[model samples]
Target: MITTDLNIKFYTYIYKCHPHLFSSLARDGQIMGLSLRVRRRGGSGSKKEIIPVTSCSEEVEITVPSQFQCPISYELMKDPVIIASGITYDRENIEKWFESGYQTCPVTNTVLTSLEQIPNHTIRRMIQGWCGSSLGGGIERIPTPRVPVTSHQVSEICGRLSAATWRGDYAACSEMVRKLKMLGKESERNRKCVKENGAGLVLCVCLDAFSENANASILLEEIVSVLTWMLPIGSEGQTKLTTTSSFNRLVELLRNGDQNAAFVIKELLELNVAHVHALTKINGVEEAFLKSLNRDSTCVNSLTSIHHMILTNQETVSRFLELDLVNTTVEMLVDSENSVCEKALTVLNAICETKEGREKVRRNELVIPILVKKILKITEKKDLVSVMWKICKSGDGYEVEEALRLGAFKKLVVMLQVGCGEGTKEKVTELLKMMNKVMKMNGFVDRSDSSSIEFKHVKKPF
Candidate 1:
């Protein structure tokens, strides 16, 4: 038997695979309450018997009335609390909202004078009564809410964890990491409590201290796991988490660490992609990524991430090109994976926007053939076509000759006939016109009919 939550994934699968059944289920109010089973014959011949398999449909449905639901969680409230803005919410949800540094009630949008949550005893009693009544449906009754963690408690824990880390007390550090992970997992309110009380800063300190220590990988992994949940706090928090030492350590891990460490670093980079300009500042970052690519051609995630990072600024692009990334990109253009080809094309197109980049591309021997072969196969046809056109417009006679010799003109004509977007068709037509002019000037016959290429000659300076 299999059990799962009736979440968005379940609904999406049903909607996509069985739309009519989903519609009927929704009309019959069975959308919120599903129970499905698949029976198959098991064992051989005389011992054959039916075995039932259960899916997400086995989960019970809890239909809480909207009024009884917390605005933040949209679940039934256990301890309803009123705020200064005269709006009521679940104690845990509202506390998390305020602890995360919000100053207004979620519903009223009114400025709050105080963050105190006054417990609504009457509402709690009414909800309990409702849950016990016949209208409660199959939903379980709300239990008494536990008292939230105080800031003082979190600060004390941080001090101990920091001391343990600095003293090289791995055991103590691991224990604290375990406790903090538990607290973070318990509720969003607890997570905010952990962050606001310096959990993130403490974790960064531990990461810096234990990074170089021998046999510290386990401890570092624990710290990273705990820190992962405290992310995206505030700008100050982000700045502290992304300090030079910490950022470099993360990059180092990305290059050499185990799978778990690599996962943590990847996630960190993704979250702080905008703020990690320091990654580009580090020497050999591009070289290291290219080396990894050379070692493993199928690593699409690393390839895509590197391309995204390079596309962030022109300086990074220049540095990337300086590392001879153009040839590597050309190699990737022919990769069997669609994603590899697409990302390689995106980076190549970005590089072609600069004069030096265009010059380098025009000089490469494999540039034209690789692009011609992959242009129709890759999803980024527009970028590929744009790069080809730019190279053709480079005004180098040899570049134009090489492109024509490689059958680029025929590909453009085919793209036009097969029907692409109007913008793409216009660009393709212009290229064909330019290629036709060049071929005629060189005493080569324009085998492509000009009438079929339907666009006025928009002359661009060669």
Candidate 2:
């Protein structure tokens, strides 16, 4: 009787602890002679407890079947495709692997002779059927995959749009551009196909042609919309589209075109630093960019983009200086919002790299004092400190004296005492040392004077 009770206890423990394994065993008809009993305590007016006995039965375990999983992602395949090696994988993953210049099978590791991916119809039907049934574990049914656009189709669309634009077929050109936008927006693969087939070049040519004709203003907007969708494809595509004449035409459009055209120009210029520099070389481009910086609004994103582009190249900085951008940027630094101030400082940092650019900054009287005040007021201090460091490092005696006169020395000392980052602290130390040597050489300070300058705690500007 004791052996039987121990066996019953062991079976009860296994059934509770390893229910899935127990269910599998039970499903196989392996559970035998298992029973359980619980003793009841404290019955009314009873000294001894009563015991109740029960018998256990078999149950089956429901789980996801193995065939529904993809070999690539190890998850249920939403869009399964069979490769040349006769192995199935999720379509998106396989396509990405193929696009990355890998010509081998992901599973078999064998060199693939073809890149074709056939849809796995049979497995998809089975997965759909399973998802529809009660045994699917509440998994939602996967939708059918859309058919991909072919390269040949994209080429035909490009041909139609180019022909229509050349012949001045306004209605035809509009329709074709709309269709191309839809195709390009459909998927990443379609966009790649459109770019590879020379769609960006076609759009640039159309933009030039339309801009030359004064009556084609409506078509210009349409073409800009289509080109905006097709842009930022690749470096190769950007190079093909950003020709000297095309770039000049784009600058003109930015000056005269509406807000939509301005947005497109912003995106195109942001494609690379090369495009930004190229645009800067055009006449009146700097003026157009500076005019766009409005104080009463928060729409300075495009101006910031231009500033980022200018920060990358020193030649662009010199060009901006030639256009008298220093005074405008200094005014912006003093009066503009926080984000615009950050961008202005970034531009100034780059400009101060050259002697001419540094001279332009030093000549501006408001540059130093406004920058010192801004450092105190702005929460973002890294860019402001960098710009100040560049100025102090590059400035001559009069410039450094100007910085000192504007309370720059006091600000640097306070920043050090208030505990800034090691980099900022080191820069401050270097600038202070430079300033001290200059001051002593000018006979303005004596080494024996211990109380020449006093350091104070920096109070919050707010």
The 0-to-1 C-alpha lDDT of every candidate, in the order given, reads: 0.68, 0.66
Mind giving the per-residue lDDT tens digits that candidate 2 earns over 226-306? 666566656654564566765665556556634555566677667666777676667777656655543223335455656
TM-scores, all candidates, are 0.54, 0.59
RMSD of each: 12.2, 13.5
Those runs of model 2 whose alpha carbons end farther than 4 Å from true positions after fitting are: 1-62, 65-67, 85-87, 99-111, 120-126, 215-245, 256-283, 295-324, 331-343, 349-366, 373-407, 410-430, 437-462
lDDT of model 1 at position 308: 60
Model 2 residue 27 lDDT score: 72
Report the lDDT of model 1 for residue 10: 68
How many clashes would you count in candidate 2?
0
The number of clashing residue pairs in each candidate reads: 0, 0
- Where in model 1 is the C-alpha error above 4 Å? 1-113, 117-156, 178-198, 224-248, 257-287, 291-342, 349-386, 389-434, 439-462
